[model samples]
Target chain A: MRQMMVGVVALSALMAFPAMAAEGKRVSVKGELIDTWCYFSGVMGRPDAVVGSAHHTCAMWCAAGGIPIGLLGEDGEVYMVLKLPGDDASNGGETFLTMTNDTVEAEGMVYERDGLTYLVVSEVTSNDGIPNRTHEDFGVVPGNVIPDAVVDKVLEEG
Target chain B: MRRLVTLLACAATPVVAQAPLPFDIGGSFSLVDQRGDTRTEDSFGGPSLLFFGYAQCQSICTVALPRMAEAVDLLAERGVEVQPVLVTVDPVRDTPASLRDHAPDIHPRLVALTGSEDALAGARKAFRVESEVIGEDIEGPLYAHGSFVYLLDAEGEVLTLLPPVLGADRMAEIAMGYLEAKP
Candidate 1:
C-alpha cells in the first residue's frame, strides 16, 4: 500500500514538477550537529554510537571532506543543515567544523523538499557543548579514525 | 515483489513535489579542462551535471563522481543527453595531465577541470561551495569541499542540486523531472 503511494507520487511528479517559489517557515530547534553521510550511511557504528564525543573526531574529518552536516533534532528528524549561523558559506567552514558534535539551540528557516527537511540557521541561540559523551560507551566509534599512536599511548597509560 | 513492481511502474526518481530552492547559486567560471583547453560554465552545449571534487579525493568524490557518471548514462538512455563535469578543488595535484589520465576511468566522457586558485575560488564562491585544506592523510593533503551535484544548463544556470547521498537512479529521476519540466 505504501509502495503504491510512492509510485503514485512518482507518476504525479513526472507530470507537474513545475517550479514554484520556495516555501519555508521559521522555527527554533535543539539538536546535536552530526555528520549526515556517516549517520545515514551507517558505516561507522550503530546510530546511537556514532554521535556525541565518540563521533566528534570523525565528524571533523567528514565535515572538512565536503560531507553535509545535519541537526538530529530532538524530534528525531534529521534536518539537512544548508547553512550555519554566522557563516555565509554552505558546505564547510571553520564555524561548522568547530560546532561538530556540539548540541545547539538554533532558530532558523526550515524548508521541506523531496522527503527531507532543510534548515538554514539564522542564529544559534545557545550551545550545550558535547554533552552526549558517547565516547565512554562507544570508544571513538570506528576507533581507527584516531591515530594509533594516540590510542596506543592512552591504552598504555591504562 | 509487489513493492518492486510498484517502483518500476512509475518514474525513475521519487518525490516530484519540489520547488526551486530560493538561493542564488549560479555564476560564470573560467576553468581549464583535462587537455589544458580553456572551458567556461557555458562550455557544455547541453544540460550537464557538475560536481565540485578533486581527482585524488578518496572521500565524497569517490562516492559522487561515479554516481554522477551513472546518472549521465541513465539520462542518455532516456534520450536526455547530459554531460558530467568535475571541477577539482586540489588544483595543485589534479593537474590537467593527471586529470587527463584519470578522467576517462571515472567516465568515458567526463570533463575533469582544474584552474588557477583565484579562478577556482571565484567559481566556488559563485556557487557558494567552501573549499579548504582540512587535514593530511597518508595519501597527502586532504580537502573539505562541497559534495552536492549540480544540474546545469548550457548557459551555466543551476537547475537544481542533488545531494551525493542519493542513489544514481534517484538522481537521474530528479534530473529528468527538471529537464522535462523545461520548455
Candidate 2:
C-alpha cells in the first residue's frame, strides 16, 4: 500500500508523448538520469520519489543488470538513453553506470517512435550530481533496495 | 478524451506509420538454431522478435526473453505470425543442443541461436549489442548484454526496438500496430 501511495505520481510523459518520426533531433536536455525499468514498471516507487539520492543504489543494480538508463527531461519526457560519451558498449556502459541518478545537462540526438523517445548522448555538458535529494522525504523508495544488515549497521553506528 | 479515443483506434486498426529505425541494427549471419540447423537472418519466414542473450543468463535476459515469448504468443492468438529468435552472446554454454533443451520452456516456437565465439560476436556487432563477462555463479558464467527486443519483418529488417521495461500487453499492442500494415 505504501509502495502504491508513493508510486502513484506517474511520469506523465510515459503515456503523454504523441507519435513522432524516427529522425534524430539534436537537443541539449537537462534531467535526472534514471533506471528505466523501475521508473516505468513502478516496482520501486513514484516518479518524483524514486529519483535522485533516494533511488541511487537500486538504479546501480538495474544498470548493472543490463537495464537501460533514461534521461527524465525537465519537461517530463523520458528519453531512453543509449550510449553516453566515451562509453559505447551497446549494453550498459561503465560511464552510465557511474552517472545514474546524477542530474546533468546532456546534448545528444533525440528520436521519437511509436510514442517513445530515445537519446544517444554525445556529451554531458554539465553535471550537478543528484540535486533532487528526495531521500529525506521518501527514505529509500523501495526500502528493501538496501539490505537490512547495512541499514542496521548504519543505525547501530548512530 | 478525444486523443485517447483516436490513439486507441489507431492501435486497434492497421497503422501505416512504419517509421524507419533510428539506427543501423541488423545484418546477415550464419548461426545454428535450436534444431542444430544452420540458419541466417533469412530463416525466419514471418515477422519476428529478436533478442541478444544466452540461455543461461540470469540477468536482464530473464526479464526480456519471457516477455518476448509472451508477445509472440499474444500475436499468435491474433493470427499474426511472429517468430521469436534469441542469438546467444554466450556461445559456449548456449550451443544448439542446449538451446534445444531450453527453448521449449520459454516458448515452443522459440528459435534460440548460437555459434562460434567469433560468429556470435559478429552477430552482436551487427545488432550493436555488447556482451561482457560480469561474474559467475554456480549456474554458469553471467553476462551483461543488450536486453532490447527487435521487431523484424519477414525479410529480417528491424521495424523497431522494444525496451525490456514494457509489459507483454504493450509490446503486443506496439507490434500489432506495425503488423497491420504488412498484409
Candidate 3:
C-alpha cells in the first residue's frame, strides 16, 4: 500500500510540473534571416533593408547586439529566431549571423506568442543564387559606428 | 478509491498548469504629457494604445505613429473610443515642447509623453521594454528599442500586444475584438 502511495505521489508531482514537452511544431522554414530591430523599424532606410546582401553588415551587428533575429518567409510570415537549448554561444548568434541577408532553409520548432512566431533553430542550410556580399562591398561596418559612450550608456542602463 | 483520487489529481494538475496567466506588461506610470501636465495610468479613462518611440526615429516610429493615429480614427468611426499615446524612448532629446510639436502632426488626439530619465526608465520597465542608444550621427543618436503597440484596458492592464508590422485597419480590428469581447 505504501509503494502504491509513493507511485501516486510521484505521478502527481510529475503532472504538477510544467510540461517539458517542446512547444510548437517542428518544420522547415525558408526565408531571409533578418535582425528584427532594423527590419521592423526601417532604421536602415534602404528599400532592400531586411533582405539581400546589402543589408548584411547592419543586420549582423544588430543580431550580435542581442536584437532578436527574424526569418521573413516568402509567404510574409515573420518568424522570430531563437537559439535552441545548449546551442554554442561563442558566436553571438547561432545561425542568424552566418545566414543574414541570404535565403536559407532552417529546420526548427516554431512557437507563436502574442502574434509573434518564434523559430528555435536546430539546423541551417543556405540556398544558392543569393549574392554573399563581402564587407568591402557593403562599404559600411555598423560596428565601427557605435560609439564607446553609447555602448557604456547601454550597459549602464541595462 | 485511492486510485481514483490519484487519477483525479493528475488530471486536475495539467488543467491548472495550462490556464493562461495574466500579462505583466503595464502598471502605474507618473510622467508628463505633451502639455507638461502630470499624468498617471488613470489619466486615460478607456482603452488606450500605448507605444514607445522617439521623435528622431526615422524608421519604425515614423511609420508606427501615423498608423496608431489611423487606428484611433478607425476606432472612432466604429464608435469605439481609444486613446493613442506615445511614450518617448529618448526622453533626453524628446522634451515636452518637442513632443507637443511632434504629436499634433501625427494626430490631434495623440498624447506624447516625456519625463526625467529615471521616470522614463521606470515607465519602460513597467512596460517591459528596453531602449538603447546604438549609434550617433550628424542628425542625432539612434536608438534600438523593442517596438510593440500595447492595447490597454481602462485600468492600464495590457490586453494585447500588437506588432508594429500590423497596419491601422488590422490594429483597429484586433482592438475592437478585445473591447467587444469584454463583458
Candidate 4:
C-alpha cells in the first residue's frame, strides 16, 4: 500500500511540470526615452519601477542612438493595417511595416532576438487615456495615397 | 451656494503646470566606446559630437550614425576635422568585437565605447541624460532611449543637441557653429 501511494504522488508531480512552465511572469516596467528604433520606442524601463510617459516612450525610439523594429505577433496572427516610415506616394504606405504601437501594455513572454526585444503579446491592450490609434497618427499615413495637388484642389473646390 | 461651489472649483484647480525635465549639461565621466577604447572628456581635438549609444541599437543608431558619418565624411572631404564618439548605454552586451564589426563602417573617425555600467551611469549623470531597458515581444528586452548628437566644445561643455534626423550639411553646419564658438 505504501509503495503504491508513493507511485501515485510521483506521477502527479510529473504531470504538473508542463502546467507550471506555461504560466508566464508579469512585472511592472517604467523608464525614460533614450532612443527609438524603426519607429519603435526604445525607452529604457526603470529596473526598479516599470513606468514612463508615452511621449518619453516615443522619444526613446525616436532618439538618435536607438533601435527600430516592426512589432512581431505570434505565428499566423495578424496585426492592424498600418503604414511605414519613408513610404513613398507610389507604394501607398506599404513597405517597412509592423504591428507597433505606443501605449504600454501587458504581454506574454518578453524575449530578445537579433539584439532587439520581441514582446510576445498574449493580450495587448492600451494603458492611460490614449485609445489605440493606427500608424496614420504616428505619421505613417497608411493606405490610399492621395496626391498633394489633387487633395488641395478637392479641398479648395469643396 | 453658487459662489461657494465656484470657490471649491477654484481650490481644486492645480496651482502650476508641470515643467519639463531640465537637461543638465557639462560634467565629465570616464567611459569606453564600442572600440573598447577608454576615452575621457578630453579625447576630441575640436568640439566633439559626443553620442551615447550601443551596438545593439537598431533604428536611430544605425540610421543616424551613418548619416552623421556621411556628413562627417563630407566635412572631412572639405578639410574639416570633427571627432564623433559612440558610447554604448548597454555595456554588458556591447562587446568591442561587436562594435568593430557593426559600427566602424559608419564613419572613419567615429569612436565606439562600452564600459562598466557604473561608468555609463556616471557619464549619463554627467550629461544629464537618462535610459531604461524593457521587455520586447520579438527579442527579450531592449533599451528605449532618446536621440541627441550633442555638440560639445573643446572643453567638453554642451552647446546644443542636434535633432535625430537632419541632413549632413546641416549637421556639419551645427558642428561648425560650435567649432567657431570660443570656450
Name the regions of candidate 4 deviating beyond 4 angstroms: A1-140, A143-158, B1-23, B137-140
| Candidate rank order under TM-score | 1, 2, 3, 4
Q: Ten residues in a row with the worst lDDT in model 2 chain B?
A: B13-22
Q: Which one is best on lDDT?
A: 1
lDDT of 2 by residue, A1-158 (tens): 01111011111122232242234679999999998887776667666677899999989878877899989888777788867888655557678789999999999887655566678888899999989988999998789989999999999999
Tell me each candidate's TM-score: 0.85, 0.85, 0.62, 0.49
- Candidate 3: misplaced stretches above 4 Å? A1-32, A35-54, A57-69, A73-77, A81-158, B1-23
lDDT over C-alpha atoms for residue B100 of model 1: 96
In order, what DockQ does each candidate have?
0.22, 0.17, 0.04, 0.04
Native interface contacts kept by each candidate, as a fraction: 0.32, 0.21, 0.01, 0.06
Kindly report which residue pairs in candidate 3 clash with one another. A41-B60
Every candidate's lDDT: 0.80, 0.76, 0.64, 0.45
For A1-158, candidate 4 gives per-residue lDDT tens digits of 01112122222322433232122234222211112232221222321111122223343334312332223222211121111234321101212112223333433344221112323334445433223333223321211234568657976999
TM-score of the second chain, cand. 2:
0.87
Cα displacement (angstroms), candidate 4, residue B167, comes to 2.1
Best of the candidates, TM-score? 1
Q: Tens digits of per-residue lDDT for model 1 on A20-96? A: 32357888999999988777666786677778999999998888777888898887767788888677676667788
Q: Could you tell me how far off, in angstroms, the CA of residue A71 lies in candidate 4 after the best superposition?
A: 26
> What would the per-residue lDDT of candidate 2 be over residues B84-150, giving only the tens digit for each residue?
9988888888878889899898889899999998888878877778678878899878787778898
Cand. 3: chain B TM-score: 0.85
- Chain A, model 3: TM: 0.60
Candidate 1 regions off by >4 Å? A1-22, A155-158, B1-13, B19-22, B136-140
